[model samples]
Target: MSEKSRFEYVREGAKTRDGVDIVYYEPNLPPGSKAERRMVRLVAFMLLLSGLAALIFVAAYIWWPFTDFPATDGWEYKPGNSFMKGYTPILGLSLGLALFLIGFAVLIWGKKLMPHEIALQDRHDGGSDPEERKLTGNTLAFIGEEFGLGRRPLLKVALLAPAAGLGAAALAVPVGMLIKDPHNPDELFRTGWSPEANGGKMVRMMREDMTPIRPEDVSIGGQITAFPMTADGLGATNKYADSPVLLIRLRPKDAEFLRSQLHHHPVNVGGMYGDLVAYSKICTHAGCPASLYEQQTNLLLCPCHQSQFKITENARPVFGPASRRLPMLPIELDGEGYLVARNDFNGVPVGPAFWEKPAA
Candidate 1:
């Protein structure tokens, strides 16, 4: 353990040079040995596996059957669209595998291929002279030399390939999010209720069974969950999850109160058909179904967090964590007397208040 018996990699073994201790130093594999080549190849294979999994993740995240396209009738969850269920799980598994392989590759590289050394350096009272600085720089260079990248070319390429790929993926995530343009009147701001989604015709409010609803269908003070009727029923699918609406037949007194408060809730202007007022089923707090309607109280309650929206005041949040009102779906009777959206919600598509706020 004396300085004279120091490892062959060093020239002069100054025991206390620069006020540091080389307590331990050993390589897991000798530099440029045949056995070292084999270990590098093994680590390279693991890195390759990690890169392959990462590529799979990127492909599945972008091009997989993730979207419930209208042409495919995405609502049925049948043979045609069942593959969509696997999309999320694939994303999870591939990303997870990619990360796991990278981690394992790093572990094996350190334990089986890289040098094993320990050094201790005491704190300095002042900046070092030129000699100390040169030694410090050489120390870093020595660590890199221990990896033998110059002597062995394969290790360099193996490290660079996966490192570049993983770097790009990491950059794409946060950068991609920061660069998205949220201002929009279509997909982001509008929903299935928008006339644009229904070929310029009003989207009829249909029941779960696909039957159009008339004014008489929802009883007085009663409410019903309704989806929009489109040619492919795209309105009914999770593609437009925020589109499900609560068509509540407000009591005469409540309807009168709503009309009187229209000045404050201007989004509800011409938003009702007689006494029937509709609001988004998705809660403004956390996107839970604000479905539990308390008839006597005229309160729409989100059972998830006990948030309450007073129906008589345009479904404005009066309790719990919700600070914003539910988006109102404007409704009127079509020529067939079935309820239909007069237009899309007056503001952004319904969800948590923090969602998209369109510039237009």
Candidate 2:
């Protein structure tokens, strides 16, 4: 069919705000039909549901009980374990529902309310004519000559100054982050067991209940989860996830073997106080708790990814994906006979390596 015949049914409508001509094609069905009204109501209902979900998402984000609660304490929201337990799921569900409803509504509106029509525009084969190109170039050159940028160096510099300053300001934001140390970098390498935390006094190794752990507390071929006795009493809390350590007491022969192979380990052999040694419970692979300890094999296993650390070999990664050895907290008997940290885990940073982490 000819192009003129193809558009014969199209009616010219009012011009748009931009002066573009509006064209209407004949609808397959008459307007204001019961089916069309039902579709309109369905689309409107979906859009309204989407708006309600979006509003709920914002409200939940602002007013949801996200306050941190101690493991021992209870909150009004009944945020079992931590206040963030239910926070993330609710936010995700509301936002996801809003987005899904919006997208589905748009799809339904297009399929049901809007008509499918084909439109065509005339195609050009080549660039503008030589005369048009020359005229355009002359116009631009005339504008440039009138501006007198070449004659006015100071004006040009003044114009460029703001752009240069803006570019510099944009560049400075990220560069400033690199130079600024908001918190101490040493904090990443040190744990709550740092000797300096307790007025230069040795920080005692304590259980989750805040009771000091004696050498007799951890039996041979057994492991006990321990935390540093901090001044603020942040033991076993989410605030101190990096502070948990597995205090494994090796058999005498196993301890002797580990002592003999101390040269292979990253930290000094003194990190072990007799047969009892404490290693960071955080897995080096992905920061999961390496809590699943096997007494017979003397391996601390991370349930998340199966990363195993040899308890009798300075907690070295003997199996799974872990590349670095578990950081060993230096321990010794305090004056009162309870186990205490001589110092923080050597100089190495704990957990997974990140972009800002220094090279080993």
Candidate 3:
């Protein structure tokens, strides 16, 4: 007689697959039973919950207001739009429910609707025989059948729809971030220090208390957090968050060393007012506030990543994760003797670098 087909051999010998010996196997409610049909419908409905969740995530991510400011193209929303107040919670709940529902559906399918079987396999080494390989392939098909893959179309389609949606939701996050930043591209290159932001007048560096800071206000070997008066003084730290600066009062000797450094860029030439100089408080590494100033070592430290900038060397990174020098806010004294920025950060954008960021 011709050799039996692999599936037929396995099916005829015992209800075994691969090398496993089935000592016992039983179906819960028998094939196509009325009660079993109800279980399949229930599992199918539960599995579909994940698909609905995926739709919620994708819709909210695309259509919902996630930014306080309106788009450059002038979307109808007002500045400080509060619609996105629920953005984080919505995304969290939708994505979380999708993950949980998919898992729960699979668990219910396994424990409630699937066949119960006990099988034992003898130890084997290396690759299985050709017959065993065919048996293994058939075994997977058999398991799918037990899950109603062939006999029930509803269960098979139910699993596929949610899987595709979950994948799309996963991809939307990173792709959406790459689309645009907090605002327009031009906004990234300008700050409150820019003359345009101040009705074309130079911006005076003022303290957080909204008081204009004179050179005398900052003592030697000390620093103060400052903001452009045009940026509503320090209140702009909320609107123009990147406008905050670390205004330092270096020792006369340290100031001299900085000006004398031959390799120092021309931006630092008139960037100082006597022994006082200012740098963007935002770290170029990850935009953390590089606020911890070490007057003893003349170094500026970023508490977030420990990135250090040598104040005596034009705030260039001398240690840690930062590579780019902190952008100097070219400062000088106005006729009234209040410190003012010469221009917006010497043509370099402040804070962390982006792919489109121009070189100094």
Candidate 4:
């Protein structure tokens, strides 16, 4: 049997040598009719709408109004905190509409103006023949020789230099980021809790508004989350995210139970209130702000993953994945009888165990 000719097989049902079938069509129109001209106008209109959408996309990219608060200083805009919080949504809508309009316009254009047809062809299997493979290989080899890179060492070096320089440029950006050490042992680890910062002065615990907390302010079965009071006696900045303490005023009986259980570092300071103790609010497992406190059960629940820490006895992890006990922030009273953070966490790392903190 003879092989089929590689040339054009048919005018209407043409199939290429690669076996890809192509079906051609020409739209029929009425003689000098204005209605046919209207169809052409409709096609142009769809295309024009697409062009307008493209222009709007570019304009939105250039000057769509948006506001971003500075990370260093920010308003405490929590959810449902204030109005005019639709800044994020507006930017999303404008960019989304711009893209959607462009796509819709193009789809409408194709449906209105273009003719559709179907064709079938037999699939070709396996690689090219030996002659074709050799031709391709020789073509590449000839091109390489034409460049004279094999003879001219200078040209070879020149071409290689740019590629090496580009690779180094790519590596330099990531290296620059890692060059500055984030784990500055002196600054990052230490806070105002250090005795040196306070000049032998004990640090007082303050509220979010810099109000000095008193034992009377917190109810006997309630808990108030507190931060380390700075030297200037102000609310702590973002630096003290790990320094949040849960000031819990337990019942007299429960306080006695804790003090007896913890013999070395007793919970009672001056034996006045008899049961107020402070522990780090951050979960040791994942560093989540463990704020969901249960007044009735004395079980502090982590809202994130339900890691329960008992508030009565040293904030010990009783249930869930959390392993380490919450760090106790040693507290004392100021001259005015307000609760204060005496020192930092008692050598206990606040967060998850990494390579730095080896397992015991």
Best by lDDT: 3
Among all windows of 10 consecutive residues in model 3, the one with the lowest summed lDDT is: 70-79
Q: Write the per-residue lDDT of candidate 4 for residues 80-199, one digit (tens) a residue.
A: 634335434543564455445445544643554333435565755887678655654554454344322342244344334334433443353233223333233333345555454456
Q: Put the candidates in TM-score order, highest first.
A: 1, 3, 2, 4
Alpha carbon RMSD to native, model 3? 6.1
Q: Is candidate 1 or candidate 4 better by lDDT?
A: 1
Candidate 4 — which residues are off by over 4 angstroms?
1-189, 196-200, 232-234, 264-273, 353-360
Better of 1 and 2 by TM-score: 1
What stretches of model 2 exceed 4 Å from their correct place? Answer: 1-183, 356-360
lDDT of 2 by residue, 83-113 (tens): 5577668767876887787678668756755
Clashes of each: 0, 0, 0, 1
- What's model 4's TM-score? 0.47
What lDDT score goes with residue 153 in model 2?
Answer: 42
Candidate lDDT scores, in order, read 0.75, 0.67, 0.78, 0.57
Candidate 3 residue lDDT tens string, 167-237: 87977764454443444445547888988678788998888778898888888899999988883343355
How many steric overlaps does candidate 4 have? 1
Worst 10 residues of 1 by lDDT: 176-185
Model 1 clashing residue pairs (backbone): none
Distance from true location, Cα of 26 in model 1, Å: 5.9
